[model samples]
Target: MGTVISRFLDALRFWFAAIRDVLLPRGCAGCDKPDEVLCASCTRLFRHVYRKMLPGDVGRCYGCSWYQGAVRHAILDWKDHGDEECDRPFALVLADLALKILERQIPCDQARALSLVAAPSSVASMHRRGRWQTLPLTRLMARRLNDHGFSALARPVLKLEGVQGKSVQAAGAQSRSRRIEGHVHVTEDLRGDDSLFIVVDDIVTTGATMGQCISALRAAGARDVIGLALACTPNRDE
Candidate 1:
């Protein structure tokens, strides 16, 4: 009876949200362009490919936008504030980033099998948010990649253990690295796997978390690993 009641309440909430959306359409999450989830201009911001330096042989990671101003605001809305409406737009942008990375790095004909990995969120974070935020992005990316002639699968094979606090709460690169180090781990063996693993994340603040993810995959015997993020923080010189 309790489970049924909980599900009924969830359904009621969903319908209420739908009705509210129809009655009072919200402006763009990125910019206050009336009735848009993410305005065209802001969507374009997510189209630029920004490179971020990573640790070890991984060297670099790619993002769709520089995390600042409107992009940051929009992401926070979707990620922290439960703006689930932004999922579709964000997923499409991530898929576009995946294609961009593939085009620049390897020809489609020569590309290996692809695996889309959602960067792990801590258990506490998932509980707090009521979802694994990146999971939908990865799944949608896999679908889009498959539509474009790539054999891809969304694999949530990464896990974060013993992590405390949030990445946003961490101040500097060194602090961020320390927070994630020794905590990101692979849930399965990748020994002898030849697939190209792509880690999908919303933000690459310091590249430490991404580098650790790539390193963990390599340690688990993944031959090739790369990261694709929705946004990246700019370097001081940039």
Candidate 2:
């Protein structure tokens, strides 16, 4: 059966990873601690919620940690490099972040399903990476939230078109916003969507991209929209 095959493949992957770890002897993605994907000290850094301001009336954005030092290294390893093993841990951190945000924002009595929207990836980036990286993180985060008694689902409805270079390479807020302007689009008609849309991204430098994503969703008739990132660059004002 398909279920049997899936379990078998899962087990196979585990054993293969174990064997590879024994042979290759890798280190923590964050600190290079031997035989660990992400050491406890580094993971503890991701447990805290850091708030950053979004442009205009898009409201605040939440991040799991500040994008600096070990946090930045670990994210770059997982994001740019081929460290796929960091996905589950990063997803859990993001899920914890969502719960923390919802605890303060939404009351228990007033419950609604959550739609986890992965930030759009440009075609060039996807082609270079060979995958839609943010999509998997959003999917895993949704699963984690569902396990914690929330109606959560992953919705990859956003798209990026006509984007050149990368957001990180852009200098300031204005340049980044201008580069992403008119490029972030909603794939389907969300005219009657009532779910709380949580946009997930790997990083929030100036929050321009996150703001743009929120704007696109709002334009497509998505009412309740917010942003969450795995990590965010330091804000001196905040």
What's the TM-score of every candidate structure?
0.91, 0.88
TM-score quality measure for candidate 2: 0.88
List residue ranges in candidate 1 displaced over 4 A: 1-10, 167-173
Best TM-score goes to which candidate?
1
The global C-alpha lDDT for each of the candidates, from Candidate 1 onward, is: 0.87, 0.88
Question: Weakest 10 consecutive residues, lDDT, candidate 1?
Answer: 164-173
TM-score, cand. 1 vs. native: 0.91
Error of 1 at 168 (Å): 1.0
Q: Which candidate number would show the highest lDDT if scored against the true structure? A: 2
- Write down the RMSD of all candidates, one decimal each: 2.2, 3.4
lDDT of 2 by residue, 160-225 (tens): 999864536444656867878889999988888888999999989878899999999999999888
Candidate 2: deviation at residue 160, Å?
0.2
What does the lDDT read for residue 5 in candidate 1?
Answer: 100
Q: Once model 2 is optimally superposed onto the true structure by TM-score, how far is the C-alpha of residue 99 displaced, in angstroms?
A: 0.5
